[model samples]
Target: MTSPAPTLLRPDGSNLRVLVVDDEQMLTDLLSMALRMEGWDVKTAGSGFEALQTAREFAPDAMVLDIMMPDLDGMAVLQRLRQSGDDVPVLFLTAKDAVTDRVAGLTAGGDDYVTKPFSLEEVVARLRGLMRRAGTAHAAGAEPILRVADLSLNEDSHEVERAGTEIELTATEFELLRYLMRNQRRVVSKAQILDRVWNYDFGGRSSVVELYISYLRKKIDAGHEPLIHTVRGVGYMIKAPQ
Candidate 1:
């Protein structure tokens, strides 16, 4: 018999609230049900306006937002949130698979993106990744510092530095780097990265991982002995300089 999916719980054994925003009531309901199954507190909004209101009231730990809506689009809502200094992590949910759309969402400070027709498990996994990387799901007394070579990450402070020089990272970038650093010296396949970092097996493109790897190399490996390496016909690995 197939086993039931496991629920994701916060480290403190309390519910982590999530706000699901979509113009489609069915989608919001479906997402709420999925999130609730994970023992998370789930709230739904059927419009951009409602999402904004609910987000403020609920103060969710993370949000799943739809890109298209009447009057106020997801981009505009996100812009408003950032403008007001609300740094809540958000995952964009949309049917638009265009590169520009994805770029726009990321540029607007979205932490992740999932296209329409996504699986419930994938969504749950992605949210779990976001929460864990954001320190929302980490249990008390967990290791707060991770280091490889001169690169160090402070999980509590959400800071990354190498060789005493501070490095700034987007939430997604930090999550990707954290995953790599945690498995340092182990070659992790792109599929594994997708599942671990994004919490989903994204069918969109493998280049997404390559793109982030390139981004990391620029920030983490620049002017240093290259710590990230590609295994021909395999995957990627991060290790200290020899």
Candidate 2:
């Protein structure tokens, strides 16, 4: 299925800020050109450290990060960003088409992925998709907070807490957790999770979900009783301590 068009707005009042992180100067320039044509403020970083610095200064509404980079990879960069409580939406650019790579990127907090050698049009389209999903142009006001068991999520603040302790989640992890919390006790299948959370049905490859679950476990379930459970051969579920 085709992705939805981004809710593009003028670069005034609520103009979207985007950060493009890539090693390819030509591709980065092209992306910047296309995004600027759409009236977005864009920044470019050729390395992970530079990307982090740019992110701090630019505070982008969304980020386009390359998976393969020197010093620190996209996944590591994403982890650091999340750890710093930045929920900026991330779209990964990967050179490898391996499922493991895709799953790793998604689990590490990427909102989306576009394989390398992609069309500029497709990249712009996907960026818009991320922005739309992030509610950047819409719902700019306060949103309600939600909770299930010890986990709490503030939609307005984009902050998550577990057992009264603050937990940092990437845009993708937050979305995934929100989906689970929305369904609560319901057993959500991997297919369903991929469709709703990733906005793509990744067929039967549930490793993405599994990988994200591991990430969540490290953050939310570590040093405590497990709240998220795998339902062998079926799917996953989140529940209160029984």
Candidate 3:
């Protein structure tokens, strides 16, 4: 019997680069191996300072960073990068699985988080989700623009605007809004959103989906007619104001 084919997350065949930052050399090597199997250019850093240097030099498309690194924890590294105006999508790896820890990471501009002792498959799935949301993995010229009334999303440019006013959105928010706008007028179930936007069904919390929807509403629906609507006991839908 033949071994299963390696998963290709990036449909566009672009040369995607990923940086894996962890103090554990073994973990970095393992992650590098798994990521390379997907045909990504994978780089590893064993320290926060080294990770910063690599991020600046390598300019990875996405990053998997450990939160407990010595000298400069992942949050500090991310803070420094953000201070320097780098908005690269980041996924935090932490041994702490508490809600506070997850929320802190997210609040600190992480695109996603994975707990320690995670399956390689789950990590890959999360990375895929981040890449997809960051608009780094999809083919260009395919549905370049999605619109619902005054709300518009330019997939190629990763831009969102409402009523001609530019709206800044994080990668995850862009992906969530894109999904909603693509399904305009239809109430998408929370499960479907989790599967499509997050690339996971198991252990997928609906609360996260709700939080993102609220974020979208603030940006896209605030001071407007409210394009995104919640259907009681169902999910969400984007519809034009009647």
The order of the candidates by TM-score, greatest first, is 3, 1, 2
Off by over 4 Å in 2: 1-7, 10-12, 139-201, 204-242
Q: Each prediction's Cα lDDT score?
A: 0.86, 0.82, 0.86
Which residue pairs come into collision in candidate 2?
none
For model 1 the TM-score comes to: 0.71
- Cα displacement (Å) at residue 70, model 1: 3.3
Candidate 3 lDDT, 14-55, residue by residue in tens: 668899999999999999999888778999998899999999
lDDT score, candidate 1, position 35: 87
Residue 117 of model 1 has an lDDT of 87
How displaced is residue 71 in candidate 3, in Å?
Answer: 3.8
Runs of candidate 1 exceeding 4 Å displacement: 1-13, 139-173, 198-233, 239-242
Clashes of 1: 0
Query: Is 2 or 3 the stronger prediction by lDDT?
Result: 3
